[model samples]
Target: MSVRSTAFIPAVFKNLTFWVLIAIISGVLVGHFTPETGKGMKVVGDIFISIVKVFIAPIIFLTIVLGIGGMGDLRKVGRIGLKALLYFEVVTTFALGIGVAAAIIIRPGHISRAGLDINDASDYTSKAQQAFDWWEFFKTNITLQALILAIIVGIALNYFSQRERIVATLYKISGFVFKLLKLIMWLAPVGAFGGMAYTVGKFGLQSLLPLGKLMLTMYLTMAIFIFLILGAILRFYKIRIMDLIRYLKPELLIVLGTSSSEPALPNLIHKLERMGCSKPVVGLVVPTGYSFNLDGTSIYLSMSVIFLAQLYDVHLSFTQILTIVGLLMITSKGAAGVTGSGFVILASTMTAIHSIPMEGLGFIIGIDKFMSEARAVTNFMGNAVATIAISKNEGDFVDREHSLNIE
Candidate 1:
């Protein structure tokens, strides 16, 4: 082969996507064969996630502050924030509706509930029984709290006479943080390997069969939401969803392996900017979306609720279903930073409705880890597409032709 042609091959092999793919395959093998050793690999993933998280707060603060400060229009910042929130609501509502519809149609929980392992869900139920206070939620949710503080600081900086100097310093720091992120991301394959190995090793494939129907239904619903709903929105903007997904493959893999969208947050912010989203839109929308726009989490929440209702043979009225969707719209926003937020939200939703048994959560907790990958991947992609759409709407997106060609 010509040297030029051979050079492309080496670059392909060196690509992060290539390594992530290999790591995922190797992880499955190790998990399936040496389950005990694979289980111990959890620390590798945890360490990588911790390292990535160390930069999240700073990066978000700088990105939003710089994005808002540099925009030179406080009204535009408010407009973008409002628009992003509105967009998140409409899309996530659609996600919840679709999830409920899919569960109703598929009837994943229509079978016998016998032979299901039931854990003590008293902890979840007890917490769920408590009233959901916005004050409490704000106090507990670190991401939402950071986002609010960043916006205040960003808006305050807009009026500061010395804003330029501070913004410039933040930009320098942003550069350093992102550069550090680049170094941290090279460990992605190791993290992916460890995360996947531990999950499969600890849970085992057999554990999934009992709840396989629910798992499959959730995945199917998210796939439809992404390719159909999100895709149509992107098409309206002259962008291909598949192309965007292809562009975001590495980050998606990281989310898949980690089963938490968080590990990829910093990298996603940088990539979105590179893909032509204006910094302000990327900063404001992405972090906010983590809290406000959880399409994947919304879908999972609704479907799981419906699945449990069906599992317990508890028939819900149309009013009850609508109530479930409405409650989810609020509860889902509080999901971002809470540990076991999914189960907690599910428990809370059931408690409020007084329909499904909170005890039913025990039936699926074993497989929750497996299902979380779907939620994380869908949530990650939903936020990415939202950033692009919002940027394009605000006339902040650039390099349309060139960015569309990103492979």
Candidate 2:
């Protein structure tokens, strides 16, 4: 065999994307044919997520510390953070509006509510009824906690005479952690396989048929948001959203399989830096954005609320619709750290409005996992775009020639 052919063979076999795609397909097939076996694969996915979570806190801490400390500009750090927050709010609001509009147009909930499975949503409803506590949010949110501590430590280190030494030490640690992450990422195919298999096995494809309209509307709204709203934003920067999406194809697939964006967080930060976004910008914006700028979650939350209203044949006035959007602006921000946060936020929003039945959550709970793929993927892409946009706006972005050269 020729050397080129041998090399090509190895490259194809070694590519992460290749394996992950294959895994996803295999998983679906397994789930469809042998659900019992497929359901067992959840452990594989859980282990992968646990392993990934182990690195998340340290990586965030190290990246933020290194980025901020290296920059030695406390003011710039604050400015970048503030700007990212403002951008997150405005864009997420737009997402909420789009979701509401799409839900109204599609009316995914206009069908019969009878025969829908009703699960216990009391936990989410009760939690939503309570006042949101910032301390509780920070305590539960590891990434946000890491971001805050890292920022404070980074700022303090800026004044330390041995800041460079500390930064260098942290850099080495960061490299080691990334190396470990690279090793762990090889399990992504396994993780994806397990996650997909479990989801399909447990829920079955037939499960999606009942709520298919809501799912379709959710996906459509996300696509529109990405192409129209986010695309226009990227165009303003003279960049192509398609190019960026293509660049992050691997990460997006990982999120697609896992149905959670958390797994892709570290890689997203790394990719943004490689794309010539400043380290400080990537570090500060990405982690913070994970918490504050959940465009997908915002959309899902808004659309779900409207769907519930329609499901129960409850007529919502324009004033009530605006009230839901307003309430979501605040509730959505709390989604960062909570598990099953989308539903929780939905529950909370419904509870607060007192118009939508909280029990309606039970109907959508079964298919939330499938829809989550869209939410996670969109949230992941939104943050990626936000990081680059903020970097460009701050004059910290470096236009690398190779950024457009995606394989």
Candidate 3:
């Protein structure tokens, strides 16, 4: 590593992990204690997230092209991409199963306000009453979607690497964008803390209490997802998941505070590459994986469906839940990566089930806001584990002794 790169090692440890946690906790506490302060802090968070989103298109395009191009043989890279996606789908279903089991067993987030009349989710009624046109939704999130399609087209075009100066130029552009992203990423702590403070100031801890049980359950489930399931995967890969976490401490901290996982993309790719995941596997899987294989989203989909089902006294049959799971599998394919997207998917999912009233979403929307931090964090961790596991399976992994020495 260069002197400049070596210098960042200490800061990544000191500021990224522990200090970021302190900032997040303080913001939540302050937001809980003083709602207005939380509100103020929210503005900081919003601005920060906005800044990150401003670059999403380039980040997705470049990193993906670079990861794909690094494979040398586009055909082999495509095959690896397919295999990685299949693995993602299988694991995502497992996540769905875990969520279903948890929801059925514990039935967390049941509001006990009997004889109390709550408004059906009116705010999202627009979303529900709107037509269920997959085509429109497809068109909406089409930036990355389109880029993936283009990559497919390029594969068919199969212009040799020498002739395809396009790929070379894109690789250079991708490198430049990643560098710019890194420079801007230095401000991540500021953005994260500001976002956390805003979340606290606006919502207050009281807001969290409404969905406290649900959030706590999700958090616990997320812990189980990490330590038990992902831990096992890490062990299978002969990699310490904890070690990976340490490598990614800075990125995960930023994801936690801001509640948007996109900002972590550059770091995740670099870390996976360092871990000896082949560039093609890391590049293609990580970017496209953002869309298709969201384990965290899968878990939340099942849990939230049940949460709303009981919240409004709508008892769903076993078959209905099976259908909900099916719908989540389809819906998750096009799930949004924005902050509070779970609720949007929740809004859409509830509509698809045709049992839960549209207005029912309001019961949890207030509290759902707080839960997304864990959701985003878990989503990120799931992808990181996937990259490592796939690399191990593909024989691309670096030795743990070399990668996990922590510099």
Estimated TM-score for each candidate: 0.94, 0.94, 0.89
Worst 10 residues of 2 by lDDT: 113-122
Steric overlap count per candidate: 0, 0, 15
lDDT of 3 by residue, 31-133 (tens): 6677676777766777776777767766666666656655567767767778887888898888988888887777874766443233434666677666567
Predictions ranked by lDDT, top down? 2, 1, 3
The parts of candidate 2 lying over 4 Å away from their true place are 1-6, 119-134, 337-339
Residue range 316-342, candidate 1, lDDT tens digits: 999989999999998888787322567
Write model 2 residue lDDT over 276-310, tens digit each, in one string: 89988887888878788999999999999888888
Query: Judged by lDDT against the true structure, how good is candidate 2?
Result: 0.86
What is candidate 1's CA lDDT for residue 299?
95
Q: Which sections of candidate 3 miss by over 4 Å?
A: 1-14, 114-121, 153-157, 161-168
Worst 10 residues of 1 by lDDT: 337-346
Query: Positional deviation of 159 in candidate 2, in angstroms?
Result: 1.6
User: lDDT of candidate 3 vs native?
Assistant: 0.74
Candidate with the larger lDDT of 2 and 3: 2
